[model samples]
Target: MADALVSIQILPRTPNGESVIPYVDRAIEIIQASGVRYVVGPLETTMEGDFSELLEIVKAMNDEMIRLGAPSVLSQVKISYNPTDGASIDRLIAKYRT
Candidate 1:
């Protein structure tokens, strides 16, 4: 099995009332459009296809957010072949548990 792993963090430039939901939604849209097996953080949303597609989608998602006035967006992505499609992704949870 193969998968594209991504960790996305959105922060407001000024700690004001910024809607992170839109950013999250855009991320989802991008992931879906990419057609690759993915697991969103907090334990849920999985998508599965091409690594290239995932890359493109992620970039687009970030661009969309920037266009929507979120320049303080940060993203970290790691892609690897799972060999056996993971039933769960504890690695991410552990990494971000703090």
Candidate 2:
């Protein structure tokens, strides 16, 4: 079981005023590549994993944005952590899915 569920919304400002959708897409790609369980929503993406790994993913996303030409990156993050029983996205929202 995972120790946390992290939801992140990344806002990347391009140097040339380009559309940020591509950058956002790339960030999501990083999440996908991590192989953690995730859910993509309209305003943010949520991932379930170890607390430290999830934080590392956030760092990777910001670093990639800078490498891709973003002068600054703004990230909004929400975390739900349960070190004892652990956290789970499915366990929280399973009732709504039905």
Candidate 3:
């Protein structure tokens, strides 16, 4: 099982001040491609995986924004880490799923 859960919301400043949704979409795409278990909430996207790997993913996400016409980025992150038994996204959200 994954040992950590990371939730992130990246706000990239567009070069021309255009809509940020598209850039945000690209960030989500990164998460989608990561192959980790994730849930896209209204405010942020959460991923469950090894702690260090998840931090690397967050860095990639910010870099992606700069590559995609964003001048700068502001990313908010939250992490829950459990190394021994680990944790599953499913287990955490089970009560709210139904």
What TM-score would you give candidate 3 relative to the actual structure?
Answer: 0.93
lDDT of 1 by residue, 1-98 (tens): 33544444433242355767766777677766666556665633444444455557767877777787775666655554343563234554587776
| Shift of residue 92 alpha carbon in model 1, Å | 12
Question: Residue by residue across 4-79, what tens digits does model 2's lDDT show?
Answer: 9999999999999989999999999999999999999999999999999999999999999999999999999999
Q: Once model 1 is optimally superposed onto the true structure by TM-score, how far is the C-alpha of residue 45 displaced, in angstroms? A: 6.4
Candidate 1 residues lying further than 4 Å off, grouped into runs, are 1-16, 43-47, 81-98
Writing each residue's lDDT as its tens digit, candidate 3 over 1-98 gives 68999999999999998999999898999998988878999999999999999999999999999998887899999999999989788888799986
In model 2, state the lDDT of residue 62.
98
Model 2: residue 6 alpha-carbon error in angstroms:
0.5
Error of 3 at 31 (Å): 1.0
Candidate 1 shows a clash count of 9
TM-score of 2: 0.97
- Name the lDDT value of residue 76 in candidate 2: 99
Error of 2 at 55 (Å): 0.3
* Clashing pairs for predicted structure model 1, backbone only: 1-83, 35-48, 35-49, 36-47, 36-48, 36-49, 37-47, 37-48, 38-47
Which candidate should be chosen as best, given TM-score against the real structure?
2
